[model samples]
Target: MTQARRNGVLSDATFDDVRRDAWPVVLLPFGATEPHNTHLPYGTDTILGSEVAARVAAHCMAAGTNVMALPAVPFGVNTTQLDLPFTINVMPSTQLALLRDVIRSLEPHGVRALVLLNAHGGNELRALVRELQPSTPIMLAIVNWWQAADHATFEQAGDHAGELETAAIMHVAPHLVAPDRHTWGDGRSNPSTLEGVRRGVAWMPRRWTQATVDTGVGDPRAATAENGAAFVAQAVERITAFCCELAVADPSSLWAPAP
Candidate 1:
């Protein structure tokens, strides 16, 4: 096998090899272009999503799984955060349309499965998957990388630009992170006025400005590159295992028969 085939990156693979190899499964790393506080770059989610997907794809190939990683989608539903400067929000309908096209394009190439590896909190894609799965021939699955891990190492995993993300960026692309700790936001978030919402029963979108003072939801002062590496390693391992299984799964009968 060639290096690109072994790596299992669609962009890096040559057309000849892609036609010859016919990878059955593809991983689409979906992320958002949004702010991650003052310390982290706007592409934090996309960077992490793409990085994690690439790593997982490489590992899957090593494990003899026919898998490929597509280039990351660097935008997502950011309706609440649109007020924040430079935050791009793609309507859910638009996102679905784009996803539908990608799925349709993969059908003729013998791709049987597509895993949507979502990295951003805002891009809730399960509903979209549910809507698309019945209409398409290919199998669809979504994996939220952050939620896959236990995340017990950090004091606060944070909803937006918090300890987990700060550490992750520090690990993946240290240069993108601001060096001065003094420049980092404390990531303080205000509580919702609704009692049910506070207790997790009711739900409502938070106004970005009103939710947090500095566009952060968790304290990132204590984040370390070491912790981030460990967290990402754990997540990658788990996600890779799942992809390997999915790659080899019989699509017509994915679930086991009952006793």
Candidate 2:
């Protein structure tokens, strides 16, 4: 256990340090490789997920919590965006299989919990977690990092390559963002004709090409690094707190007592 150099990042930790350290909870940042309008890079989700997970893990380690951040899974359910160039889509079944293997690998290492720090909105994983929880000894949990924080700061946090995401990328990796704002796309989506779908009474994946002009669902013109930093900080604080509590929680009695 190299406490002096510990950062709770599994990729950076040495084998000797890992074998000796007590990792009660491990965070797996899951993201997708896809387009984020014309300004942000294709790897925005992956980068954001990895960065947030790393920050949370570092905070946890600093606070003496036994938590580890795993390397992010860079591909996600991009079924609707497959028509777009270079967009990679991993089927739900494949995701389940991959996650199962990850859990199996951790079981022998004495890991007691697994937190899926999901960054991609398309990765519908709640059902997957429910399906796997009963059979696995490792406690399963998921957190959509975007929804982890309040969005009162931004005017409109678009669904995709929009204000919130663009701001976030600007904060984390400014180099990846295109400096020429003129080339940026206005993330306006074409709403469905069906009233049910438009009103959230029904559900269906929007066709990327038909949904928006450039795959963006929100406006990114007002995005600023300052706002992004503030949002990310809030998310990190909330998530770190949750991870810390989960690390020491009794799995058998996770629910609250009779009220």
Candidate 3:
């Protein structure tokens, strides 16, 4: 009935008379299934990823970009949180294989590219993308939201499960946020000093137990639903603009400046 479908903003929701080359951009919300301290839900990654992705889709509609938002890939790199009760982790290889299949499916269509709105911090997915570059003609760009849109605000908040995340949960899914359990630890200071942030220069791995030690990071007391709304909205706006720009770019021109 409409010009936009579910995950791929350019799809036809009716699925009737669907043409092979009718879609636009294919957006993916990749997230993790891990704990966010004691207050946030295990679905935090999915919630944030999907919500942000949806916001981007909406923005694209306003921007006149025929992009669609896809359902989120809930399980991310949670190897550290594997020890936690409900957390699950997907291997990088598995993610790569899955992405390859999905990309292949969209390559023949009008889906010009893919925008990965990522919520997890694990960088393994970056490597996975590189592996898929050859077979997948679709341009893929990964936007680690926290890094892409809100790094400044996050560093100001100190750590996770702190102000930023608490506010985000409160704004997106208040029911999942335990207002009473919202607390902070003083061990990892704001912008955690290089010493507190480093495990090993070359390689480092943190056990899930170590994560709970800090539960959530940042200053939850400082978090407010208002800030979350503002930040999430900004992220969506930026993500949409980024996607639109990529949607029309010359694929071979990535080697040079946009100008």
Candidate 4:
């Protein structure tokens, strides 16, 4: 079994062991099955999400915080990239239903918080969370791992299959990355779309084909394992800190004014 299997991972732990914990925080890694340019694997998002969750869970457990890292949900909202041959897309409504059910299961199990460790850009859950919050008893949070750290940390803040992702996969799963076949992407954007997003005034789903010819948004030629290692370390540290706080937070007063 893998180290991830031994450390309070839900897929690896028995029901008896899981039930013994008073109120563990559950980490659900969410990813998508889509092409990651010519170099990275289709499962890059899933692999990265799962790896981050496992690391955070192991860190929290060793610190005396009960945490369970669930296996990554390999399918996410990939509607934009459906044109890609092997991309698997799940509708936004489908994702919401899946999450609602997942959350329902954890509440009765004494789970305090359900953190969605999201890895794909297309899997936005804030709207679903808003709709579900009033109905559910458990506290839910979403963490876009890439957004947790400062973009200035890397030479380039890539959009997709770029230096940022390439470097991360290199460190997290080096064997799966083929840097030798690196490609270039300028991470282009329609000026109007960029401006609207920056102003928080407009929004629309991007057509992947129109975005880039290679299905990539950033340049990967300069990506290196060292760069990946540093970025992943920073991201893990930030995520682990958030999980630690979630573990001890009281659901009743989670949003109540501090004394």
Candidate 3, residues 1-259: lDDT per residue as tens digits? 5534453343234455345335467688898777676677888877888878777877776777667777788888766666677778888778888888888877777777887778877635678778887766788888877655565554355445667777788899998877674243432423323564564444455554654465555556666788888778778777778888987888887897577
Deviation from native of the Cα of residue 202 in model 3, angstroms: 3.2
* Model 4: per-residue Cα lDDT at residue 120: 95
TM-score of 3: 0.84
Would you give me the overall lDDT of model 4?
0.82
In order of appearance, the predictions have TM-scores of: 0.95, 0.96, 0.84, 0.90
Query: Which model is ahead, 1 or 4, in terms of TM-score?
Result: 1
By lDDT, the best candidate is 2
lDDT score of residue 39 within candidate 1: 93
lDDT for each residue of candidate 1 in 107-134, tens digit (9 for 90 to 100):
8888888999999888889889989999
lDDT of 4 by residue, 1-259 (tens): 4444477677788888776777568889999999887788999999999988888887888888888888899999988778889899999899899989998887777787889999999998898889888887778899998887777767776888888888889889989976456244444444334777668788777788776767878877777788778788888888888888988788787766677
Off by over 4 Å in 4: 1-4, 182-201, 256-259
Whichever of 2 and 3 has more TM-score, that candidate is 2
* Model 3, runs deviating above 4 Å: 1-12, 16-21, 151-155, 181-200, 257-259
Q: How much RMSD separates candidate 2 from the native structure?
A: 2.6
Which candidate number has the best TM-score? 2
- Angstrom error of the Cα, residue 235, model 4: value is 1.6
Which residue ranges in model 1 land beyond 4 Å of their true spot? 1-6, 257-259
By the TM-score metric, which is better: model 3 or model 4? Answer: 4
